[model samples]
Target: MITSRLMVLRRAVCVSWLSSCVRKQNYCSSAKKTRVREALTSLDSGSSIRIQGWVRSVRLQKNNLFLHVSDGSSLHPLQVVASSDLNTRGLTFGCAVDITGSLEKSPSHKQRVELQAQKIEVVGECNPVDFPFKIKGHHSLEYIRQFPHLRCRTNVFSSLLRIRSEATAAIHNFFRDNDFVQIHTPVITSNDCEGAGELFQVEPAGNEHSLDEENPHFFSVPSYLTVSGQLHLEVMAGAFPAVYTFGPTFRAENSQSRRHLAEFYMVEAEISFIQSLEELMKVMEELFKASTEHLLSHCAEDVELFHKYNSPAHREQVNLMLKRSFNVISYTEAIEILNHSSEQFTFKPEWGCDLQTEHEKFLVKHCGNVPVFVTDYPYDLKPFYARDNEDQPRHTAAAVDLLVPSVGELCGGSLREERLELLKTRLARTGLDSTYAWYLQLREFGSVPHGGFGMGFERYLQCVLGVDNIKDTIPFARFSHSCPL
Candidate 1:
């Protein structure tokens, strides 16, 4: 009797071991399936595939389920159909899941393809009660702004971000193909590039209270966040002939507008051995075209979304923009056009004054709505670094502002003043100290006529994606009075 009992116990143990081995094999096989994109392209309809992604939306039916999953590549969602026994009781929105299924072309007219899921495993769970995006209604921008961490999971935000990444890559590829060496410029500097007095002051460690004490401050010299990388790139251009810097730049202005940001990304390029301002304009045109064409070709889904949901006028404008060559108008001509216009502007266009946002919009909207390079601004209105045109009026400089539809001032460039004496005189007249001795030394030693401009990365993203707010262009935005997650 004892021997028979021992035999029964051993057999039961062997059965349990076999069951565990089978379960392990099943898990390993599921892990080795192809990605969603690959599965969709393959001609085999019954091929086994597995995909893992965050749950975008979940529709629960009495006998089955429908889920939209996004793995963060394209804007299109992967449709997943699950059976009733998938154990989805604890699953909620934004939950991560692994699904093993057969890839099938869509039978319904709406979907392109569908995944008939055989097994669904819950990789992670999200609590619906605590989640901010659980409701099935459109959330206001202000309310959605509170959840920056989870906001990217939304359809609109995700689409905008995908376009932003594509546009940035396109910009870099354009510079690389044109023999421009990428340079890293300093973020903290003593000199102001824009000369606009809108820089954010950077306080040194242990000197936080020095300003209050009023003893000339025990600080290691005050430094401020750089508003532009133009000066630094100019110095580099003298050595490298052609170079560009793409990085973060900060401004301290408190204006609350759709176009302004406290901190933003800038792309500054300076090229030496350039003959005239026309060459600079050509480079700007090529950069704009390259970036726009890249996004339009590669990001079809995102572009479609922009056309559908964004302003109706925007689609027509974008189509018209790419159809023809951009127009070139001098600052004087732009003033004339604006002055003659039947539409009234708040700040009327004048020859000596800077182009306000309203004037830029009018020029783009009426004048073919294509990118325009408005050149020859009043030197006094521009930075001290811009090269003054000897042939033009007294304060006029050889500067150009690249204006696009819905995005004003995409790029700003000029022929830099390379003469040492003239630069020094301009700096002194502008009341800026000659503290940057090295920068001035470049002009003194072996300077050539060099010119460059800074393009805001977020601004380019806004134009490419047709997004209105600059805050949504970046993953983690730091704007005035707003920094959520």
Candidate 2:
């Protein structure tokens, strides 16, 4: 009935707007705010265009002043050539300027076309001495990390930002195309989805009232910033056949490792009625490949910038990762391979122990460094939610971890324990039966076999771009003790 009503409503709306919704121009129709990249890409000679962007470089010739301006649309900046007769007032590197110009074919071989500016107005000025970045030469990613607020002005970071935006859209598109419902999962909740005890506590501001027993707590039972949305996606999957959530997830681990972050974006999804791990793995593989292909097609120039300048070694790895099928191995097999390896790992290879970064890297290396999935982990290592593999010789959970080249564990997931009594027993053993009683109710009322997976958004970006640190992928680096704006 609900779906029928939705269909009727959609039809009604469509019918009502047929006459009113005449086709409109596809692109932005603006005379004042022309994007620098678009203006450069669609250069029409003798056309007057007003463009605004931050100055990337300035070269003052005897007869002309040439400036490369960028508005973050592309890796390459728009070349604006202004004669000395024009007002070049307050023009400097990092200054935001609006230029009214006539587009013309470039006389020089460097650029296809250049903007011949008739007027130049500096909207915002930056003092060269105080500016953190130089007008010329590439700055190291670490050096730019210091100025998180202004690093977007840099070519490398700007390209990264573009890739991130495009990748996000591509991911959403893939899910939408695959008939998955997008869920806006809560950021704050009472339960720890991962049960890792690494949640960031969410509390009100400090005051005397906060200490009062009568109204002491914000949310009576100690609310926390969610560490994962997997559990919530699982809830939605009960109603919707397929559900996914992409949002910020918090963790309070204090490690200062390059991979650790206090907060990061996660893409999590839950699917109902998945019979086997193979079905779940197929969706994972498709999601990764489709979204990556979209990025390669849509953000070609931005990706090229990373290959040409940022991380040259990743160029071939990325191609192979996308072109070929991902390899798979059982956790037992991975352990055997690790044990027989010549390289001594920091963490010893053992049957029941969790795989560390070194161990995961070795497993990926064993498969020739393309993405690989390791399945059937020790039951004890997995969470209470994982489905039990009773048929296996040793106690194992139907859990899988997708490991990529640079980033060890790119994604983790499992077939959930849909059996009511089994879930109850597992939760009881973990002392979370009462806490997740509502979660158990889904199994009791009506539950089918279900499973889901979660990927760290930053980690995926790091792996794709060959970024050494997780901090570089995000707009702002948030770590154990650092939260710079």
Candidate 3:
């Protein structure tokens, strides 16, 4: 759903390790430094501090030289005041600077404190004529996207990166708090977990041995980038009570849609001894609520930038989601609701057909635009591992999908077919029985009833931020052919 320019910005300190390397150092190396966020909250007026960051704006008055500097510690920048004589040719917007100043109370009501500069030096020079981002105006997300290498310098994307970083930490904290063992699943695998045929086949870079179709494979068999970690988590489920994995996943999908991406992250969790879809849905719902609450509390300022500017109406939508309990409806009832709706859908609603994007959106809207769980899908629509519902007249699978207002399907999961005979019979229909012999073995020995769901990480970000495009949610977007540095 999203990749970003600030590839691995640590939420712990806003910028952390990268701030030291992001810009050139052209000032004193003796004095200790203070992050912009740390200085902003300091109550000691007259305390000496040095800050290094890109100059956001510069104002040269008759005697006073004011500069706004930010090191990505927070959404706001620190205001600096100096003598006009201290301002030089290099003190311009987008230029990185290091300044030693004393913290003092600000006369302006906009901020609590301002820096009274003792000395200022331009560490990294940036030409105003060539800088993609200007000093006086805000750039659109689309305009900034063309320059992925420098998008992090912009206020909009920087705030987004900070929020993304905190959201990641919050998720980790949630799973750890719930006693879910964090499992690092493999990125490359021999099995196609989604079975969608959208796998990105992997191979060596060079033909050292002059390999071909009949020759030996790299792993002696076909392998591709993982589409999901659910199957691997299931294997862990056999030995552990609960396990979760959060990592990148890939799909060789040929599209440039706003909601699609070639690579994204997923949070997959598997729980042993899970009996029904209700228990699985409870976990999913709780995760969402917990993560969102954490974001609202920790990333209030950063999130406000989106709620107040990017998507003004999203603030109310988020409140509604947290206030109301998610509604539940069966697949049959969802089809009935779609059939009775006045809106005409391109893919007509039917009994066994999978729900299209339009249908999913309509269902969410019908449920008062809150998150809704639609369960008990047709047997054929679900994957091979979906436990049989055993309703003879209308066969269905114990599967469920959590659909949000903007994002059609944020998560999908189902109870695995733990019965050895049923799983073997299902795999036999497609001649995959032998290929999945190890998977069958998981059920054979000490297999307990288990279920898990994988939520698209980027989609979750998009859903909360009300970001229109999935690309904006991520840092460096990887699509069909556009992979930026």
Candidate 4:
């Protein structure tokens, strides 16, 4: 009887312990199932949602906490309200967090929505003392430039970047739809495409030497960063009827103006057997219109901000640009117009003189906000590769520069000199090496009438966004005095 009682008591104790273990396992499983909710830009009233983003700002009241969070999508902030038990302590600006809440339409403002938080999860921490950005006031461009990595988090910079991205996509789509083959050109080039002596030299490893070195340094071959990809695109155009190259180009020019950059992007296109400069101008007009219209359709918020802050003249300019047809004029006519204009230019307009930025701006702004292509430049003023007009005086070349208001000389193009003999004569005149035997071979093999143009990508962005500087258009700007993270 005693043994039976002991066995029964032991069995009962074992069963009780097993039941407790099972209960604990169930509790753990339920806790592990808890997860963050999906993110929605705008939530309907009386609907529960969860959001995750960096905390932009925070306010603490006696019994509640108000937090503004940004998820890097829109310019506006999402207002989050949390109760006192949500552990608001150690919550600093810029820290990432996840919040579960019921969204409600703002009683005071119809445009705004509020989230009342039921739970809060801190994903990351930020030190307020060391944080570079603040929620109180705006920072100057010069100050924000110091922190390039962090500046993109701001409203203005974010808007500019979004627009830049949309513009790039629009350009690619335009070219793709027009049957233009996208070509990638080499960056480290041995040839000078732009003949404008503004090239950044690259030396071989261990080739550094003093200027007074008696003998040429070992492994020192003259190399340079390409100023343009026009020549390379021509080679591709020979294979493909229509081709374009969009990539980075570098220049060593010591320009201190808002227009120039040490390194910038260029969009270059070359076509084979093109009919006339008129056709080329048509392409330019269509491309600009397509790019602008695409951006306006997609980037509404960015366009609104751009018009509000940077260019109050955006609506009028865009309307004028869309309605007005491009005006075709010769270099001589451009000079005449500049000389007749009331605005006195720094460099007085003269024949054979390259159009100054001031001269080009006046022609575009006053002559109607349409692109003007000034063609048939004086032979001596153009590069050796440009086709010279036989009928015109001074051996003028068939070159064109598309100028627009605010952004002068947006593009430059010319019909290539196809005649081998004439090209050789022009090359000799310009002092280029005849040793470019491979390039000459293209003409020898059967070169046809071809023309191409190069548009400054940053300049286009500047015009579209109405941003003041080229540095802001690019993510990492390389300038004279500054190169920062």
lDDT of each: 0.74, 0.82, 0.84, 0.75
For all predicted structures, in order, the TM-scores are 0.85, 0.91, 0.91, 0.84
**In candidate 3, how many clashes are counted?**
7
lDDT of each residue in 235-290, candidate 4, tens digit only: 88778889998899998867767888888899899989885787787888888889
Q: lDDT, candidate 4, residue 49?
A: 55
Q: Which ten residues in a row have the lowest lDDT in candidate 1?
A: 1-10
Candidate number of the best lDDT: 3
> Candidate 3 regions off by >4 Å?
1-43, 209-214
Candidate 3 clash pair list: 2-474, 3-474, 3-475, 3-476, 4-475, 4-476, 5-475
Q: Compared with the true structure, what per-residue lDDT tens digits does model 2 show for residues 210-318?
A: 6667766777789999999888888888899999999999999988888989989999999999979999999999989898888988888778778777888687998
Task: State, as a TM-score between 0 and 1, how close model 1 is to the true structure.
Answer: 0.85
What is candidate 3's CA lDDT for residue 144? 86
> What's the TM for model 4?
0.84
Tell me how far the alpha carbon of residue 436 in candidate 3 is from the true structure, in angstroms, after superposition. Answer: 0.9
Q: Which 10 consecutive positions of candidate 3 have the poorest summed lDDT?
A: 1-10
Model 1, residue 221: displacement in angstroms?
A: 2.2
Instruction: TM-score for candidate 2, please give it.
Output: 0.91
